[model samples]
Target: MAARLPLDLDPPVRQLRALLLGVDDRELIAPTPCPGWSVATLLDHLMSLAEAFTEAARRGADAGGDRPPRPPSAAHLSPHWRSRLPVRLEELATAWHAPVAWRGLARAGGITMPAPEMGVVAANELVMHGWDLARATGQDFAVDPRVLAALVPFLSAAPAEGTPGFLGPRVPIDPEEDEWPRALGLAGRDPAWRPPRSHDVPTVRRGSREQPPAARRA
Candidate 1:
């Protein structure tokens, strides 16, 4: 059999770092497409993820399996988590590259997961929510082809039906393609979207003649 794919941390780490550039204080509190999560809420969740992956990397390498504990309440969800995100990312990245034995593997919660599945897990979060942050802030963004190529398959394995969670609708994804249509389709937006209402869609301008300004008066 062909060897299974090894987890890659460099691309994800680089992507996360890039996403942090020029993020505004106001934008963090702005709403995101992820249901009830604001950009700050999303950041809080990502911060917790950095801690979890870092702890997993450290403890998984040790004998006797010391799993890092999680906070018990949702109240501390935003404040406590986002506060320590950067520190934890620095710590985990340092350990992840060092020489270490890879002894972690297991299955849980219907997903056949490994203890050192930290890299892929982190990659998923950074890739998806990184896009969420981009759209929320109206910033120019593009998923690196390498990152999407790796992640789309992983995401495709989950159910096509929608649930209460933020998985959004399952659009038909060609697991082998490089285009953004597959990803956007899965996320509840069409690639070639034109709003249904005449007032909602943007008008196109051609040649040197500027389109009349959209109505300013209500």
Candidate 2:
């Protein structure tokens, strides 16, 4: 079905872009939820994945079918990362918009699979890692309910824990919970994860009252 060829990716992609843009040089060195990956390394990984998946969507001569996927490293990040990454994210969404992009087998990260499945994987990467970046940076984030609903079945069937370089053990949650929390649990993320409370979120004070600052999001 034509529906299988593409899922509108622009929303999650844009959300990811917002998170990336908000990152600063100081924050780049901060660690992410991904084990051993700092913000810079994670951004580098996103850049690599975006390029790989774009070629995968192309499935054409220009696609680097013969080339093995590059290992993501902070050293590989471009000096122009601030400008380059957002554009690459846009390209990733655009590349998948074509119906032909999903017509056959596609390869990314040295793995080949049906293009539709790859497309869904792309969505998962954007959302899950977007959450990772937000949490690591102490930013507010929310997924569209429909988006989480779409991912429920896939993550639901996935293991509670994963190996290094994959999802870690699934955090416990009420099985009958909101899709967002449930999805996080299924993705091996603790729904309760928080930035170190060493005053990571500052407090605000009015003339007579003080209020704890909250994470900001769009």
Candidate 3:
């Protein structure tokens, strides 16, 4: 039997739902701190994760086997994501809150782990993605200290390099900074990162030489 999930998981779940509620359709395509992922793309990923973890909590270690590939398009955002995601989020929270859900091993993303540990991973996912959405869409994002504290062990356990799905190298952060910044940095995201301005052009200059007329024209 697995241990019970920590009592503090609900705050991150609630925070994620609140961020989802504030997203507007017009902002779906806005770039987020997550490299190459727009708001809509990130939301799609979040929804898929919620579904996977919810199923894991409901079914123990047998769940999330042979998971379906996530759709590339943001079609899930149609019919208004606000109407859809919050309901799913609520269901996810409710499923994980059941005492039985935390009493055995669970599988998520094809990896089987203790149910209590998976619960912590679920909450971390919510908080991280919530911050991504809020930062991209210009909403105020504040990390729940409980959520941050819960994730510290996981972060500390992560390798200094070679972790898949991270955008860049782990950014070094001062010990005196708040846990929010420390956590983001450990996850290989800069907490102070903002989306590039629309007018900024990415130029590839070879040896500081301008592109030839033919290449430029092409």
Query: Which candidate has the top score in lDDT?
Result: 2
Off-target runs (Cα >4 Å) in candidate 1 are: 1-5, 61-84, 98-103, 106-112, 115-118, 162-166, 172-178, 184-218
What local lDDT does model 1 show for residue 97? 57
Q: What are the models' TM-scores?
A: 0.63, 0.84, 0.82
Taking the tens digit of each residue's C-alpha lDDT, what string does model 1 give over 9-58?
66656555655664567566666656567777777666666665565556
Residue pairs in candidate 3 whose N, alpha carbon or C atoms collide under 3 angstroms: none
Lowest summed lDDT across 10 adjacent residues in model 2 is found at: 203-212
TM-score of 3: 0.82
- Across residues 70-167, which tens digit of lDDT does each residue of candidate 3 receive? 65356664455567777778889989878888877999877888888888888877887887887787667777776788787787677877266632
Cα displacement (Å) at residue 206, model 2 = 18
User: Would you list the C-alpha lDDT of every candidate in the order shown?
Assistant: 0.55, 0.78, 0.76
Give the winner by TM-score: 1 or 3: 3
Q: Sort by TM-score, best first.
A: 2, 3, 1
Candidate 3 ranges with C-alpha deviation above 4 Å: 1-5, 68-80, 166-168, 199-218
lDDT of 2 by residue, 24-105 (tens): 7987878887877888888888888888888888873336666666767888889898899899999999998898887778
Which pairs clash in model 2? 160-170, 161-169
